[model samples]
Target: MFPTPIARTSSGTQIAYKIALPVALVLWLLPLIAVALTSVRSAGDITAGNYWGWPTSFNLLANYTAIFENTPIGKYILNSFKVTIPTVIGSVALSCMTGFALAVYKFRANLIVFFMFVAGNFVPFQILMVPVRDLTLNMGIYNTTAGLALFHIAFQTGFCTLFMRNFIKAMPFELIEAARVEGVSEIKIFWYVVLPLMKPAIAALSVLIFTFIWNDYFWATVLTQGADTQPITAGLYSLNGQWVAAWHLVSAGSIVAALPPVLMFFLMQRHFIAGLTLGAVK
Candidate 1:
C-alpha cells in the first residue's frame, strides 16, 4: 500500500488557522445567523432586549403563519414567481439565439456587437431606469408582473448574451463543421449540438438569474406597486415598516423570502459551479 501523505504544520500555526476559520465564518454569516435566531424569538423577548439570546419559546411557525395570514406576503411571493420564471425562460431563450449567432457566424460587426453587449451589461441601472419605466408605462403594463418581467428579460439579456457567446465560443468548432459538412441545417446544429452542451450553463444562469430577480427590490418598487404585483424583496421592506419593533416576525419574513434561492443553490450546486466557471478552464 502506498504511504498516506501527511500534512505538516506547526501546532501554533494549526491553532491559529482553527481559530481564524470560525471567526471568519461567523463574521461572514453574522447577519444571516442573527436573523435566523431572531425569527424564533417571542415579541416579549425582543421587547425585553433579548435580540441575541436564545428564544424564550420557539415561535418560528407562528411568525411565518402570521405573515402569510395577515399580510400580502403570499401575493408578493406569487408575483415574484410570475416575474422570475418568465424572465428566466425568455432571457435564456433570447441569449441562446444571440450567442449562437455571434459565436458560429463570422459576420461583419461581430466584435462590435459583442462589445456593445458587454458594455451595456456594465452600465448603471439608473441610466436605464427612467427610460425603461416610461416604456413599460407606455406599453400599459406598468405596475404589473408582466411589465416587471419584460424589463428584466431585456436587461438581463445583455449579460446572458455575453455569457452564452463566450461559452459557445469555447466549444469545439469542428463539431459544427462536421455537422455542416453532413448537410445538417444551422438550426438543427444549434438544437441538437449546441443546446445539449449548454445544460450546466443553463442551470447556472437560471439559478443566478432567479436570485437576482428575486432579490430585486429597487426595480420592483420602481416598476410595480401594491402587494398584488410587488415581489417579496419590496414586500419585505414594506413589511418591515408595518412590523415596527416586531423583530421576530420581520426575521421570519426575511428567512422566508431568502429560502428559494438558497434551496436552488443547494440543489443545483454542481451545475451552478460548472456554469459559473465556464471560461475559467481555458
Candidate 2:
C-alpha cells in the first residue's frame, strides 16, 4: 500500500514537513540565485574577488548585450537549433516506428531486439567517445552540426524507443484489432489510429530530447571545436579572455541559452503533463 498522504500524517510529521519545505526549496534554488546575481555583477566586481558578495555595480543590460555584441553566442545558438531540431524529429520518428513494431509484432527476436535497445542505454557514453569521434571524422562530418546531430539521433533513439514501446504497449490492443477487422491496411492503422494516440508521447519526448541536445556540453566540446559548429553550451567559453574569465558574462549567457528550453517546457506544459500522467491514474 502507498504511504499515507501528507495531509493525513501525524501533527508532528506535518510540522516537520512544513518546516523542511522552505529550506528544501531554498537549497534547490540557491545555485540559480547565485548565478543570477553573478550575471548582473560588473566585471570589476569579479576582478575585485567580490563573488558571492554585493555587486559594486549592476550591469544587467550591459552584460547581456555584450554577449551578443562581442561574442559568437548568437551563431552558437543557431547552430544548436540546427542540430537539436533535426535530432528530435529524427529520433522521435524512428522510435515511434520501432516502438510500434516491438510492442505489436510477435516474433522470436522481438524481445532480443528490445533488450538490445535497453542494453545500449546502460553503456557508458564516455567509453564510446573515442570511437564515435573517430567515426565522425571518418564520415567527413567531424566538427559539423550535422555530425553532432547524427550522433545524437543515434544515441537518443534507444531511450526514445524504450519510452515509446511502453507507452504503445499500454494502449489497448483491441483498437488495432478493430482497425484490422475493418479491412484497414497496416500502414493506415499506424497512421490513422496509432499516430494520433501517440501525440502526447511525441510531445513529451520532443521536449526531453530538445533539452538534452540543447544543453549538451560534453559532446559539443568533444566533437566541435569552434563557434562555426559549437552549440551554446560550448560556445560560452568564447566569452573568456586569454587572461580573464568573464564569469558575469558567462552567467548571463547561460541564462540566455537556457531560455529556449524553459519556454518550450512552459509552452508545452499541458501536453507534457498529460503525456507523463496518461497511464498513471488508471
Candidate 3:
C-alpha cells in the first residue's frame, strides 16, 4: 500500500487558506456572475430593486432574442467575426514567415530588425492611433471592417513576430542542418519541417489574437463608425446608450458578445497552454 504525502501545515493555517480560496475566487468572478444573473432577471425585477435576488423567471433566451431582434446585435457579431478571423490568419501567417527569416538566417541587420519589432509591439496604441486612423481614411477602408482588420493585422504582427521568432529559436537547429545536408531547398524545409512543428505556436497565437481582436473596443470605435461595420464591443457601447436602464438586455448582449472568445479558449486550451509555455524548457 502506498502512503499519501501529508501536507504539514498548521491547522490554523490550513483553515485560513481554505477560507481565503473561495473568497478570492468569488472576488475574481463576482462581476461575471452578477452579469449572468442579471441577464436572466426580469426588467420588473430590476425596477423593483431586486438586482441581486433570485430571478423572477429565467428569461435568458427571451433577453438574448430581444437583443438580436430589436437591434443590430447579429450584425455586430458578424462584424466581429469578419475582423477577428482575418486578422488572426493574416497576422499568424505573416509572423511565421518573418519569424523564420529572423531566426534561421544570419544577416548584418537581423538583430536590429527583431529589436524594432519588439519595440513596436510594446508601444502604446495611442501613439499609433492617430496615424493609423489617418492612414485608414486615406486608404478609403475607414468606417469599414476591412479598415479595423487591417490595422489589427499590422499591429498584432509585431507581437506575433516576436513570439514566433522566440519559438523557432528554441527548436533544434540540427534538423535544419540535416535537411540542408540532404540538399532540401529552403522553401521545402520551411513548408515540410518547420511548419509542422509550429502547430503549438500557431494554436497559441490564434486564440490569443482572436481574444484581443474580439475585445478591442478602442480600435473598433476609432476605425468604424456605423452599426453596419462596428464590432460587438463597440456596438455594445452604442447599445448601452440606447438601452439606458434595460440592464437585463444589456447584460445579455454583453455575455453574447463575450461568448465566442471564451468558447475558443476552452476548445483550444491545450494548444494555448503549450504555446504560452514554449521556450520554458531549455
Better of 1 and 3 by TM-score: 1
**What is the per-residue lDDT of model 2 for residues 65-115, given as tens digits with 9 covering 90 to 100?**
988888888998999999999999999999999999999889999999999
lDDT of 1 by residue, 1-282 (tens): 244222366777778878998999999999999999998888899999998878899987888898899999999899999999999999999999999999999989999998898899899889989999999999999999999999999889988999899888889999999999999999999999999998877878898888888888889989998888999999999999999999988999999999998998899888777766767887
**lDDT of all predictions:** 0.90, 0.89, 0.92
TM-score per model over all chains: 0.93, 0.87, 0.92
Estimate the overall C-alpha local distance difference test score of candidate 3. Answer: 0.92
Which candidate wins on lDDT?
3
Report the lDDT of model 3 for residue 231.
97
lDDT of 3 by residue, 1-282 (tens): 234222466777778878998999999999999999999988899899888888988988888899999999999999999999999999999999999999999999999999999999999889988999899999999999988999999999999999999989989999999999999999999999899999888989999899989999999878998889999999999999999999999999999998998999899998777666666877
Candidate 2 vs 3: which has more TM-score: 3
Clashes of each: 0, 0, 0
Sort all candidates by lDDT, best to worst: 3, 1, 2
Best by TM-score: 1
Clashing pairs for predicted structure model 1, backbone only: none
Which residue segments of model 3 deviate by more than 4 Å? Answer: 1-6, 10-20, 274-282
Give the TM-score comparing model 2 with the true structure, all chains together: 0.87
